[model samples]
Target: MDRSLRNLAVALVVGAMAPLFDSTIVSVALHSLAADLHAPVATIQWVSTGYLLALGVTVPVVGWLQRRVGGRRLWMAALVVFLVGSVLCSLAWSAPSLVAFRVLQGIGAGAMLPLLTTLLMQAAGGRDLGRLMAVVSLPTALGPILGPVVGGLILGAASWRWLFWVNVPFAVAGLLLAWYLIPADGPRTKARLDVVGLVLLSPAVVGLLYGLSGVGGSGGFSRTAVWLPIAVGVALLVAFTLWALRHRGAALVDVHLLRHRPLAASASLLFLTGASLYGAMLLLPLSFQELRGTDALGAGLLLVPQGVGALLSRTLAGRLNDRFGARVVAVVAFAVLGAATVPFALMGPGTPVWVVVVVLLVRGVGLGAVIIPLMAVGFVGLERDEIPHASIITRIAMQVGGAVGVAVLAVVLQRGVAAVGPVAGFQQSFWWAAGLTGASVLLSLVLPGRPRVAAPATPEEAREPVAA
Candidate 1:
């Protein structure tokens, strides 16, 4: 790889890993945090949920923020905020305080996740998008795999607060590297901030997420508390879409990007991938811990095979995407994922351990094939100007879809478990997960048949004045 590509890869990896680390690190420490803080499970759950909510709320603004402040400055600032939040979380005296700090950390984290990709891809000048996306996605693929294992080790050897503290080095290192390595922002452009659109979009996303979260909580969908916000949120989103279209080029999210076939298909596929991938994420661990009698650590450990599979396939998937096309890779991958999930549907408490591992390995491979290409293909046909909008929309889709998928799976698993035994409950959930994966496969069919490869930049083209 060229030196610039190597540096970009390092930056993307470091930035992406920070959030993934937090997602998993906290899971192991949640019990410890609750016990030490004298908090209930319901209350402690907010640490994760609050962070997610913060992520959802803040992510939509990233495009505007990038344009307003510039990517390098915004990225470094986000890291500092995350570092400070991590420290506050470590020093928290109460559960509520910890949850509050986590939200702050999440705001920073949410911005960084999409920004890193957008920035690096911009720097690459649209060359090697597939390979770059593969590297960037490694942290995402590894987070769940390493999260539990690392969380378990930290819990075993240290206090729960270390989970937050563990981020200190990575954050510091990322900040330093970003400051030095990331190019200074180009000439600042004068653009309207769309304050009115911000007002409409923020609450709409928050309300929608809040309503989805409520579905799995005490209030069912019928409760006014549940339906009211959801209804309002949907209405607000529709209003924002109309308002954005009226404003045309100045709209906050540039809803016009959706008209691009590659981006639209990519976002839709991401939603399905989120549903199938994360829905199963909820069910898989429950199956191990609740039915198979594995402890949290053991379940996390067993899930490593899937992570390994993803890791193993990252380079290959990227190469395949570049060679064949995202359509071929994604459709086949989703098919594999759908098929792999079927064995889990057949799972019982007495299922063999080796069988579960093999199934997860297959699922992991499918996951690898789906996510990398889906992400890369979204940028296809997008002008340099459109990358940021595409990034923000796709990221939001993935996060919201994950949230919705987990919520739906929670309800499904609860009803399934209640109707059948614990083991059977997981099986039913697995079947549902498989169905979602199959839907993703169908969506993959709609992806652009093949992407046109751009020729290597000639010196004239490279030296030509660029338009942002």
Candidate 2:
């Protein structure tokens, strides 16, 4: 990578960290949020679910939005929106209001996430994708480690409002750095906005996610309420896929990209990876709090070693992916993840903390290794112009996988808790998580073999809007 591209990546990563960490920061504060707002646990969950749905709602339109407004301006604008929403969320007096403000925050966050990847790779001019992903993944590697600990510290000493307040400095600093260091947005010239396509795609994603999220509270997919939205969402998504197939490049998300072997494999693997990684995160904290009687902060602190392990592996994983290929690295990583998860699958309440800590550290390394490679390998053969489409497609897959994973596992966990005990509940969830990653080991076979040094785009291809 060129020095200039490296500098841009760093600046973009700094901005990227703000939205990336916000939800995770808010995760540990949910129980506190319920108490303070005097709301039922069911209602309070909207704080998280609403944010997730809002993300789904915004993601499909972002590729168009990125082109119409230009990425730099759109990013800054999204940050400003997030900052305003954060301040509003901090001041919310009720659960309903907090949930509403979180939606606003989520919209900004939704746009920011995919754009972060698009802007960085677009600037890198498609060189050394694996190395680029290594740098760009800093927030991903750190968020799991620091977010809960930070959230725990705030909730331990201060009001739940401080959770939203903490995002201010990062948002402000990121905005400033982006303004100075990032290039200005290119002129807006995009393929015509596909209104029908957007109508079908956006609501389809939002409804699917909303329905999946309801599965946890409703107990399972068997409930009418849980299944209804899911059925409708799936129908809508199927219709949209048909529409995209007819229109080809004119559709909103360009579903045609799935034909690319690397993109398809990477997106599929990301889906399962999201499910496994996210499901484990949900189970770990709640189980620690319920079964071990650890406080929120204490639980967060206990997970720090996992974060350390991920941080330690970042460079090594990136080098290996670039050199040896995503296939080998991803397969080995998934195997390690599945194997490390075994102890958790069998763990009891009295299982030693030292053992959990060791397992988490190793598991974190496997997760970090697999994710960085998958993120890079998808773009191996794409032109710079096609990146935004790939970005949206991959993001949607990963996000959907994560929400469904947590929901299904949460229902499973609840049942296990009712049947046996909290320890047993988490144990069952870990088994499911292990199974998810284990399946991905087979899916990894489809990833591109040892990557050949890719060809860069022509000068004109680099200049076209991402939607082009």
Candidate 3:
């Protein structure tokens, strides 16, 4: 990547680290949070649940926010919002207070997630997506690996409040870098927010996400909680589609952009990617604990190989995608991912630790390859103004897909375990993951374009207003 793109990636990634790590890192603290606040586990779970729900609701409106405030200012404002929320969370007096602060934190984080992608893609001007994704994927690839380790170390040595406090430095540093490195967007003084579209879309996303989350502990889709909100959410989405198609350029999220094949295909595959990747994440830890008699820490450490593999693969995948196109790269990537995942499905107690670790390394590479190409493709042919809308659409797809994946896999495991043993149950679940990934392989064929660098914009194109 060139220097400007590199700087933009660095600025965005640094700022993004706070929220990305904030999400997964908190998973380790749930039990302690429950005891310290004298709340039931169910009540305390909202600390995470509220954050995610707030995220779901907030993400759909980011396009309007970006147009109104400009990317650079919006980014800096979001950092401060997150920073203040983090500080309040550290001082939370009770479970209710913590959950409330986390919702605020989630709102800020929701804006940041899709905005980061928009800013980076804008800076690149559609050139070097493959190479740029390599740089952008650094924190993303590291967050899951580091989240547990960082959260575990802090919880081991200090009060659980430190979990919230830990985000302070990253927020501060990210704000500083963004202010210095990110170019100020020329404000679109005439732009107007799509109130009607936002009203319909925001709750639709939240309802769907909430319903998907319910699919886990309750029976999958068979229960009212899982099916009701989902049905309502889908209905709202269809309503928004009708409204957005009418508004066209004024829609809060332009469903019209789905006409772009690259964007549509990328969104589709990201759903499966989310399902497969997260489903495996759920199964891996449980398999280690139930089958291998490993503790939480040991199970997390076992996951290190997959993360390392992903890390090693990002640069290679990006380079290949830039050189070879997403189609060839994605097909091979999913195949590797599917093949690596199968070992877990077939593994017995007699399977060696070294063998599992080796397979995990290969699995990580598949993750690195599959995610970067899919993410990059959505913006491949998008106009400058359409990027923010595309970013929100893709992020929601991946998030919802992941929620559905985790919920589905959990249900599958429950059924499998009831029918057989824990080992057999886990293997069955892993088979589901592998099969889901294989399905993604078929979807990968629809992703657009040949391998080549994106053409740089001329000065005239650069000066044009980035509008729908």
Task: Pick the lDDT winner.
Answer: 3
Worst 10-residue stretch by lDDT in candidate 2? 459-468
lDDT of 1: 0.81
Model 2 ranges off by over 4 Å: 188-190, 453-468
Better of 1 and 2 by lDDT: 2
* Clashes in predicted model 1: 0
Candidate 1: tens digits of C-alpha lDDT, residues 9-42: 7865785577778887797777788899999988
Q: Residues 1-468, candidate 3: write the lDDT tens digits.
A: 788788888998988999999987898789999999999998988998899999998999888888888899999998899999999999999999999999999999999999999999988887889989887877777776668767877888899999988899999999999988998895665578788888888889888888888777747789998899899989999999999999897888988888777888889999998888777888897898888998767777888898899999999899888877888889999999999999999998789999999999999989888888899988876778889999999999988888889988999999899899888988899999999999999998877547433343774443222211
lDDT of 2 by residue, 3-97 (tens): 87877887778777877888899988888889989999889999988999899988888888888889999999999999999999999999999
Which ranges in model 1 have alpha carbons more than 4 Å from their true place? Answer: 218-220, 453-468
lDDT of 3 at 187: 64
TM-score for each predicted model, relative to the true structure: 0.94, 0.94, 0.95
- Give model 2 RMSD, 1 decimal: 3.5
For all candidates in order, the CA lDDT equals: 0.81, 0.84, 0.87
